[model samples]
Structures are given as structure tokens and as C-alpha cells.
Target: MIPHQWYIVLESREIKPGQIVGVTRFGERLVFWRTTEGELVCLRDKCIHRGASLAIGKHHGDEIACPFHGFRYDKTGKVTLIPANGKSSEVASYFHIKRYPVREKLGWVFVWWGESEPTHEPVYFDNVDESFSWSSSRHLWPVHYSRAIENQLDLVHLPFVHTNTIGRGKKTLVNGPVQVVRDGNIAFWVYNEVDHGQKPKKAEDLPPPDFSRQHIHFIFPNMWQNYILDKMRVLVAFVPVDESHTLIYLRVAQKFVRLPLLRKLVDFLALRFSQVVLHQDERVVITQIPIATQLHMEEKLIPGDLPIITYRQMRERLKNV
Candidate 1:
């Protein structure tokens, strides 16, 4: 969508060792694989020699051999050897495909979708330490990546769309002031004392609950994080397949549950519960007509829509950049 510098398309675990995974992102067919040395490679899925899908090819050590013509391509997307040509043939010099830069961190695979060399490392949760355990899942949404992203920045939807779970009988009206701040491509939102059907209390009149703080953040393009509590966090990334489709990756990070057996139990229960909540959001977001449309033309907004409005504006600015 935005002229890509870098877009995260999948988690590192999804692309296993010696395995090639075909990903259709931003309207392009990409093949991701790990070489024998454990390095990750991403290239157009189409073989340069005869246009065969590389996804159907086999991996030979650090190279992928085309199934149709037996043309072997190295991890760099360069033709290493073509059976149709002589061993001394310079054919490998002339046939090469585009190679995208990829990096794996925090169990996620990040691909640079833009033209320039990325100067910074991919973002990860620095706050996660020995106290936390993490697990993730992936879902494909039949909606634009922008739509999926806007849904994350939207705080107003919780009471209605997620009322049964996250909202849990809370007030539907958003009466608090929403704050937005940007640090480079990352943006953070703080919704203070938001009304959720409970009686409003004065700031000085209340004691802090076990997990009272609420915050959400957007890491440019398609990553989002919600600090649900001091011990729990949710990380989401939207992968664009085209103008009207996306693959959503969800990860639940948790802390304070230190016992090995108990951690596994907690993660399992938390992941399933989170999946239900996410599916509800997906059902509503994916069913919207036209997928992603001009915000002004699609719906009128009030104060509660401030986060959505800010998100759109930031997206527009990134597009222009």
C-alpha cells in the first residue's frame, strides 16, 4: 500500500528450517525459505528461467531447485546452475531475481518492502524478560491491511464489538480525552479514565487495582501492541496481500507466571480466549463493504472516533513520505 520500506509479513516460526513458504503479499508472490546455514531468504516465487512457481521446487542445501526445468537458484535469488545449460555456461550471470531483505526477531520475520536499505533494526518488545512467556497465531482476513490496522487503533469498538469479552458489560460511550503522540514511525495512545458504564470516579478518590493501567501503541505500517495489564500484553501485525486482503498475526505475551507447568497452562488458556475475542473483531471488520474505503465517505464521526481519525491522518502522512 504505502511504498514499502519494510513490512512484516510472517512470524519466524511459520518459516521452518529447510522449508519454503509461499506468501502472496502486496499483490506479489513471494517465496520465503531458510538456507542450510539458517539464514532466511525471500524472493519472487516465479523462477526466472521458465516462470515456474518456486514454491513447488525442492530445496537442495542452500539452493532451491526448480521442479520444471531443474534450474537451481541460490538463496540470494541468483541462478547457481541450470541443467539445460553447460557447466561452464555464463547463464547464471544473466538470470537473477529480486531478493528482499529479511530479518527475524522476537519470533517474527520482517521483510523490507521498500527500496532503500533499512537503517534500523526491526522493532521488538524490549520489556519482555525472564518473567514472561509468549505464543502466537495467524489469521487471514478478507479486508485491506489498513482496515485491519485501523481496527487496532480503534478504542471505541471495544464496548460494542467486543462487549461480551474485553468490554464485559462496560459503558459504550467514550467520555475521556484521548491522547496521541508520535515518536518517529511509532505512535502511542493513552485513553484516561474512559467511561465504560461504571460510575465515574474522581482521579484522587480511587486506589490502584492489581492491573489498572491501559495503553495501546502502533508501530508504523501494521504492528500494534496493547498493554492489557502489567503481566499481560497483546501484539498484532497486519500483513497486506493486496488492496483488499490481509494476513493478521496475533501474539499474546505474558509475565509473572513463572512456573513451567503453570506458564504453559496459562498461555494455552490465554491464547484460546484471545482467539475468540479476535475472531469477533475480524467478523465485523472483514464484512465491511468495499473493504477499505475513504474514511470521510464511509462514515461520519464524533469525539469517540478520535483515535481512528488520528490513525488515518498518520497513515496518509506515511503514504506521502
Candidate 2:
């Protein structure tokens, strides 16, 4: 995981008011809840006293009370009421657990995963407004988050992996598959054709792809967008669960159909087809030798792997920064 970036953890609708939701993310146990006013809060699940799971405890208005000892805590993870120490007794300032800074945007919950305080909110895809309706699907992959993200950046695998679906053309020849990077974000334009015993062109040798055309875009941390059309898009979030697991959240957003009923049908069908495409990639990705990938690996890379190579280099630089 990058040291100081915001990572998407869950969708906005997942947490209900007055409900304590416990889940594991970034290899740590976290407890999330909403106050009566619908404000979100996140804290480490473990309690300071007796090491109890605070998520299983009760909710007292805006505070949560540990089940084992009835030690109530506020949103900041500071002890508000210690039953063991009388109600009137003062709780020490040092008695508190870790609190994660959170931000909500575009119907997703993002959490800061570093020691330093965050200076900015999560960056989202621009031009997508409330007019777009979306449908989402989630799948868990038994590989590292980095591996899952790299699969999306791979341009050469479509012809082989998704042969009958999106890759029916058998475009074995990859030309440029041009990549553009800006501020830790990347946009990709693909130019593939059927192999005819001709030499493939280098990325720099090809002419610039049309900027007006739809392309694939990815932002730092863990979010990707397939700008299929002005009114259509496919968004994905590669959420880290552990060293060997990743939760993929896929969504199809479209604004072409405005009727409530028809929009529902369009989103549902789009998401269903999208899931099929995702599963195709999953079957091959899970078999990779290592669950994770590094900037410098033992395996050899080809010219077609420019996007993946760029991703690795960017990731390496971010980890150290």
C-alpha cells in the first residue's frame, strides 16, 4: 500500500446510521459506524482494555461501548465513559485507540492509511455528474491488490483471455497502446490489430491517439475508469484485504437512459456483462506465480507491457515518497 494516499474502503450505502460495521482492510481490523446524524467514523477494532473487539459492543448515541468492560468511546477513539472507573471519574488523555481519517466522495468511503495527517481529499474522475446512474458488483480475488490492478492495465491479454467476449477480433498485434502519465495518474489509448507477420511499432513511434476519443484512465491509490463514451463508463476499485486477497468493486455508470425503469435494466445488464469480462481476467490472474508484483521482477517483460511497467515504476516511487 502507498504510505500517504487515500484508499477506497466501502460504498456509502454499506454503513447505516447507528450500526457498527467491522471489516478488515489494508491487513488491519477496522470498525466503522455512523452517528445519528449520519457522520462516518473509523477506529481500530481492538480495545485498549482486555483487547476486546469493540465492534461487537453496543452503541450509545454517537459513542460506542466495549462489550467486555463497558468502556464507551467517542468518534476520536477517546474514552468518554469508563464504567470500571466511576461515571464522574476523569479518563486520561492518553487512553484512546487509533482513529483513521475518512472522506466520502462519489458514493464511496475513503480512509487515510498513513501516519501523517492527510492534506487533500481523494481524487475522483471529472465530468461524471449526478445525471449518471450506476450499478455495482464485488468479487474477491485470491491475489495481492497490485496484481489485480496490473491485470486491468494489461493490453495484450484481451485477445487470449477474453477471446469470445471483448476480444473476438483476435487482435494479436499491439501498436503503442499509448500511455500518458500526469500527477500520478495514467490514461491509456489502445491501437491493436490482427497480426500479419509485420513488426509492431514502438509506443513513441506511433502518432498521438485522438484525445477526444474514449480511453482508459487510472488514478493513484486504487481507482480505474473505462471511459467508453461521454455518457457511459466502467469504474473499478481494487481494495486491499490482506497480503493474499483483494476485493474488486466494479461499477457501470451510464446516463443514456433516463427513465427510471429502463435505467435500472441498462445498469443491470451492463454490470452483468462487465462481471463476465472481469471473471475471465480473474481465472488467469490468480495463477500468477507470486500473489504480488514488484517494480523489478525476475520475469522478462515485452514492449506491449509498457502500461504495467509504468505502473510498477510509479508505485515504487510513491512507496518511498
The prediction achieving the highest TM-score against the true structure is 2
> Global lDDT of each model?
0.77, 0.91
lDDT comparing candidate 2 with the true structure: 0.91
What are the runs in model 2 whose C-alpha is more than 4 Å off? 204-211
Using Cα atoms with residue i matched to residue i, what is each candidate's TM-score against the true structure? 0.88, 0.98
Candidate 1 ranges with C-alpha deviation above 4 Å: 129-131, 184-212, 294-296
Clashing pairs for model 1 are: 4-113, 4-114, 5-114, 170-196, 171-196, 171-197
Deviation (Å) of 49 in candidate 1: 1.7
Give me the displacement of residue 156 in model 2, in angstroms.
0.7
Question: What is model 1's C-alpha RMSD?
Answer: 3.7
Q: Per-residue lDDT of 1-321 in model 1, one digit per residue for the tens?
A: 776556788888788997889989889999998988899999998888778889888999899988898998887789988887867877637788888889987777888877776767776546545466887888988899878887877767877888789876655655443354554344334333445457534323444222236667677777787877778988888999888788888888898688889988888888888899999999899887768855456587766566677777777777788
